[model samples]
Target: MATELRTAAVAGSGAQARPVILVGFQAQGNLGLGYLSSTLRRAGYCVELLDIELPPDDIVAAIRRADPILVGFSLIFQFYIRRYGDLIRTLRAHGVDCHFTMGGHYPSLSSRQTLTTVPELDSVVRFEGEITLLEMVAALAEGRDWTGIPGLIHRRGGDIVANAARPLVEDLDSLPYPERSFAPEIVLGHKALPILASRGCARTCSFCSIHTFYRTAPGKVVRTRRPAEVVQEMQLLHRERGITIFLFQDDDFPLFGKKWRAWAHAFVDELHRSGLVGRMIWKISCRADAVDAELFVRMRDAGLYIVYMGLESGTEEGLVTLNKGITVAQNRLAVQTLKQLGIMFEFGFMLLDPSSTFESVHGNVAFLRDIVGDGSAAATFCKMLPYDGTPIKDALEQSGRLKGDVCAPDYDFLDPRLDAFYQALARIVDVTGWIHGHRALTPQLNWAWNELAVIRQLFPRLPDTDAYEAALRNLTRESNDLLFTVVENVATIFATGKGCEPDPQALRRQCDMALSRLLHERNAFMARHQTVLLRALQQAAA
Candidate 1:
């Protein structure tokens, strides 16, 4: 049911005309937009990528000048949905009647909801957008009815209609490397080298949103670009775009087991063969089980500078509860391997799972202390949240333990209680790092502490470090001050339960103030420490 538009020659020239404009996140450093722009250009569309981070007026002016027949917006983060809607409204107010289409994680999961919210959106691409969007542009260019295009959702009269979801692309190598040339020089700036070597993850972590997308299709239909193709793209980015830092934005780079090893070997061989082995430095996300000393050495030799691993929990039970499919042992080994290889790494840890108890929380701290000994390891911790469509949310909902609606903004991955704890721990960790004179951990720790203080002020009765154990006594006093406020507020609420009428708005305001403080403090910390953190990271790698 898919149709390809025939190329048309211009009146004055023999060359064929390409679709004039394509808007995407050229400035946001997102891989989805890069893929879309590249695929569209390969399909013979003249693409102009727009950065979502730019001002609304600037975006509007660019769109007006381009006067594109097709305006494609790549939606990656749910946080930007409202902002995108505002921009669309602006475009409409300016009498720009271009066909608006959206693609990305949010649209892929909740197509109907997205269409309902952004009624101005002419269509939404449900899943893997490269081919779907390419086929759509062809149909639109040929003036053909697009009702038959798979993975498309359109508004029909008063109803929203979705075509069948498209099949996953099996041979990922067939797709052309994402076109970076379409991105504006200013938009790319100095740090814009995002690449993807593989697609889909094998692990079924209960709290992750990745499953929501992969579940659309059956089985482990993971695909990877050939090693030569991956290396070629890197060379092109370096030679043409002046890009040096290549980040492999895959969920799990080594999903195909030993297949990744083969690819890594081949990739290194290809880089050496092409004489561009040292032209760029690269980073990739991988499971703890995927890396080893040998593999790290190979990757580092081939310009792989950083490896990001998700060490979700420190306990076996926590790992099982989250269905991470890996153990704490593997996580430790992975970190050790990276360190031994002299390759930089970033460790991801998640605290505050539904099953997490005080024991598990303490275990996490112990595990961190052991692994991050003397500030030699680089790691970051985040609080767990039950994202929509994840098994964790489903299990919690089924067990009747998950309170409130999952769609509520307040129910984000980092709930207030856990958020405060993580913030405090992060600050303690940062301050500890600073005391040790490990500059790399200072910014991260300062940011974490400021955030903890803000969240503590906002949510009065949350527990603090002193209440937990003596090991974290360094932060005990600060924790007591934060926890006392929480206890006092709880006392007030309980005392008013019988005959005293309490204003709900007052309680809500207190909660809102806490959240605002957390946000403000976190931002201030980042503003103060971003440059220092970047410098430390750079120097550590050097």
Candidate 2:
């Protein structure tokens, strides 16, 4: 099946040309690679995907088998660059002479430094990669001059040559759907899938990198695929891949407001016509301002099971400082609407920022507690880090909030002072205990419900009920272990002098004990609610 899929992918007039191999999520699972692969394929390049998280030998074997003339790595996080370096070194050790390259958020912002570190990399495709990579590969494959490619950084003799930046794809509708055929099949258990409907953000939030990278383009150029095209792809997935739960990977899926509603209705109508309306559930990201009661109802009716939102800060000052461009009232309204619609969601919170004080942090915590209702939602809160090319980093550099050159990828998220603040802040939020208590238990509850639904679907015949129940029971125990591990780690971090303390050893042990107890209580709560939670999930599935 894999071979046939690959053959069909390259069976075109352009199949005679040398293939371009694209590596994605070398160590972590991310969405950028999918976009790159889709764009490359659309531009008439045969592409191969390699997930470096697989065994080193497997990656080497795949590279050897594909024998591509050019390779491109898509990086979303800085830590993954080191993994790419390892792959590059391994390739060299095996005498593979393919030209190496990369482009994504990190490289787009810090192109010069990235080019220097991995000189083995022949070039770096900067900014929007679809046009840049397509141009680069065509030039190389056809043995033509490469100087005209706008978004390329290459070495000319001993000097690094950077061409003019390419403008963002103004009409995103022109791009092809992401080549999901290139996605590596990893064990995501219940088949969680990520999909993107659009690119670029409309807001210029201070701590975000999306606006800075896309700021070259005018306001929100929020382009989207036609509703028919999106529905066509969803139908294809349903028929071909058994994907029933899609997690929209768009930064802001509903950025166009009313336009999104129209698209949603069209999408649902299409699904209903195609007989796939009730076959799958989906989720998407939305801004607080984009969501309201009417929109939530439309979304829920269209089979949206979840809607992730960036409720970044709670305090008015924190919101203003982050330039979130939305008020707390709007945030509350959005959350309430989602809850009223019976849609589940995960709200991301940026816990500690530059302007954060004890009072502000407490206020943020209060806001989180109120919304999360004791952290029941599949929500996450973390300290803010300055991604390169964000307005916050630029502002911090100008105001001396950040020291030294910002080009290096070694910016630590846990500076001593920041760590201390987070440590204190976590106390207010109780995130450590929350994570320890809830992380493991919730998935088990979810799995239990899913198994029961599957049984009911296949009832009377009853295929391996004992096996399914055993799996759920084992998963619940495994979840408990994972929670305890988190509790231990958080406690150690808080207790150790290396993390955020003066008394060091004594403080560490004390914090560990306190956190352990907190987690234990949380575990007890999960245990008590496990049956009710599973039943609710079963009911939802029904």
Candidate 3:
């Protein structure tokens, strides 16, 4: 099946190329491109997906070799404009140009502007692209005029034309499952794959663009798949590719609204009907208010292991500023609830957003303490970024506070002192926790927890695992406390070092020492059971 999908495609009248190309970032998964590929293949056109991270020379070489009828580029972020331009220039310079077009959240919302920026792109496919993209390929292959197609922007004659918008996919299950390599990503020893149960977010958070994106298109902003179909896809992947760790990549897993709850309940029922209780585990991201004890208990029994919430801020004022509908109490209650239910959880946090002050920063730290102080999960956060299409970005620009350009949009803090505090805190965390290239502390803890989850499921009688989990939690607690102290001390010093030690090198040394110790403890514990762990992962997928 895998081989057939990888090599399958029926040719069009004029697009009898070896492999039709679709380019995007594939660091972990690129399901957007996956859907486009599947949609085109369903209509009898071969598609190829290429990662944007590949060298320009290599990408050009692939296009030249395939000589595809149409090349689609997936641009998710506005900052990627310059990079895509450089790549397109290279492709054209190398004499490898066909029809160039792009689509994604950023491009979809700002189609004309993006066309102006990346002029080489012949057109832009706005909003959902499955139907639109297929329509485009058919038109291009049969030499049909495509300027009037909905959800497409392109040049006609001497002027750029903006066609009518296309309706969003109303029935998600009516579409085919996203095309995949079927070569699963490895999590500890278990094979993992990402799936989505729904599309679009219902919330209207100020900094978020997901709801805004869906709203611009014509249809129900939020749609879900049939529960039986979702379970059927999972069962198929599990049987065919040995994928046991299912990650639901829903913007908001349909667990909040009254109508959504019915869908959620049916999904749980389908999982039970398929008897997937003890054979697999899954993870999902959802809003905090949805973390109910009773409903989650049913989900937990049906193989739910971890839940991630967008606990963006812990202070009421910060939540207000960020336009998160829930209060600080709701966020705290959700975290506490998850812990009580014995479900592992992680969260998205922003210590500094568009609105920031010294007091708010301190309050955020206290909130972080409330959640991760007990070491139920590791602490991780960053300042909020004003991306291209978010509501906050428009607000910032209107208020004349938008700093930087389209590529790297930013804003000045209300107080310059807070700016200084932000820069200092960023350095500290960047060094000790969230380093991009390397395996940093926070991700280490996350992976360790995931590994522990897999182990507990595979070996319910595995002795000493509880002690290992406890030690891991204690280390996480310690790490969170130290970082909170460092953040507080740094902020206080920026506020004139009130009640803060002025030690500089010592703090850095302490961070290094703690990180080293963390690695040592985790490694020693795993090494002690290396032999057992070796077989654990093998049997997990087997």
Candidate 4:
């Protein structure tokens, strides 16, 4: 059940409290909304978060229970836009329309279209909404002109006007830490908290909308927190929430290019200075070009367990097509460096894109075999997905290769044969529910990763530490073997689909059998170790 709106004391005498409700899908924890809710509370506006993930009926029930004066939806993905529209209509039908606003990636780019389409949404807040939303809500509460406010789009007597883009928040440290404590129902078992050390990426990857999203605003593309502030926040979460693992949500966590070295050193220094080095473990994402072996070693010692690198393509031509700006050699070096340093890493590969061909696909498969190997590490590969306001999408539009609306474009390959293969592979994978589905390779990898984390918590005190470590190593290696075998078989089907009349039915059956075996083995391993693992954890804590 949704909680009732609690009142807060606003400025001035006898001011009637007007509560704010932030609505979003609970796919994962809405950290953006969490930050917004905290910021609102700091400014004295009563706020409640209504995150609906399950049945549609729950959404209406939550909205009715809150009965807020203002509702803000965090519109990040275009897929959810229709669902949000339905939600707004339901609220309006119930005669509950105080104010409706939305902000995030999708709305920031298509504000006019969103407002015009979803008539119930009164206004759309533009990029970096924390400050803009706080001010907008305050103005709306006191009957002030919000039109002058920068970073807002609203309807004005049959005219949709978008105010000037607001300057990027220079001092990110001034903002309140996101209120993660308020949304307890959605918290997962691991108690792994997601923290952002920085915002935005400096890369201009043609496939990404991040760079374009920030192009309108004036200032540096990437904004980072002072290292001390980040460590302090981590320490606080560690102490208060009993969270031992932190996941850095920065687009390019190691920061990018030559600038990251100094920042990394300072960050590691603070981790040690604050005594958080021994207590907490973290994971981050970065580009291949930005990795330095020595810097990574320091980070590993300071507790970085996993590093996710975007190795978008294996062939240089594919890399160039995506505008990744890094060579295949650079990616190899980064992967080799991590392997040498004994750091666990994963790769994000794009095997199929606008420029992918038979030769490139073969090269990508070979590359996967080399870097990823038969059974060692975890990696995920997929075709490039186009989004609104990205360079690739724009190019596709100009070339007439795109179908569907601007919100969600369906793209065709440059080569019809390649398109056919992709479609066939997609169908097979979807039907088998093994490759890219929720229970696919990535989730299995995540489960192994998380299980190891729990095991590591109890590593220091286990009576048979050496034997236990051996068992973990064996499990990890076997897990990777299963993942790689499944991936290779799937890749063969796609890589050969264009040239030969491969038996996709046979291939799909093979994949299903392999995945079923892997899941059964994994479940057995977990069941076998459950009692001992729990005991070890308890012993360590005691």
Cα lDDT computed for each candidate against the true fold: 0.63, 0.64, 0.82, 0.73
Q: Is candidate 2 or candidate 4 better by lDDT?
A: 4
Candidate 3 ranges beyond 4 A from true positions: 1-15, 433-437, 497-508, 536-542
lDDT of 2 by residue, 1-542 (tens): 22322333343227435688887763323656666677667556777887767788898888888888788888777767777878888887888797788888878878888888787888888777766676667667777777667878888888998888877766655666666643433222224467666777777888877767777533345666666777777777766766666767777884456677787667667767776555666778888888767756766766677677899998898899889988998898888877677666667787667776555655776676567633335334666777777877777766656753433422223245445545554553353333324333343344333434433322233345454444444444443344333433444454454453233344445445544544454355446555655564454345
Q: Write the per-residue lDDT of candidate 1 for residues 166-274, one digit (tens) a residue.
A: 8776677766666554343221123346788888876678888786787775435466678888888877876766665676788888533676788777777888897
Distance (Å) between predicted and true CA of 487, model 3? 1.1
Clashes of each: 7, 2, 1, 0
User: Measured by C-alpha RMSD in angstroms, how accurate is candidate 3?
Assistant: 3.5
Give the distance in Å from residue 293's predicted Cα in candidate 2 to where it truly belongs: 0.4
- Write down the RMSD of all candidates, one decimal each: 10.7, 8.0, 3.5, 4.7
Could you tell which candidate, 2 or 4, scores higher by TM-score?
4
Model 4 lDDT per residue over 305-358, tens place: 788888989999999989999999999999889878867777788878888886
Candidate whose TM-score is highest? 3
Report how far off residue 224 is in candidate 4 (Å): 1.1
lDDT of 1: 0.63
Q: Is candidate 3 or candidate 4 better by lDDT?
A: 3
Q: Rank candidates, TM-score, best first.
A: 3, 4, 2, 1
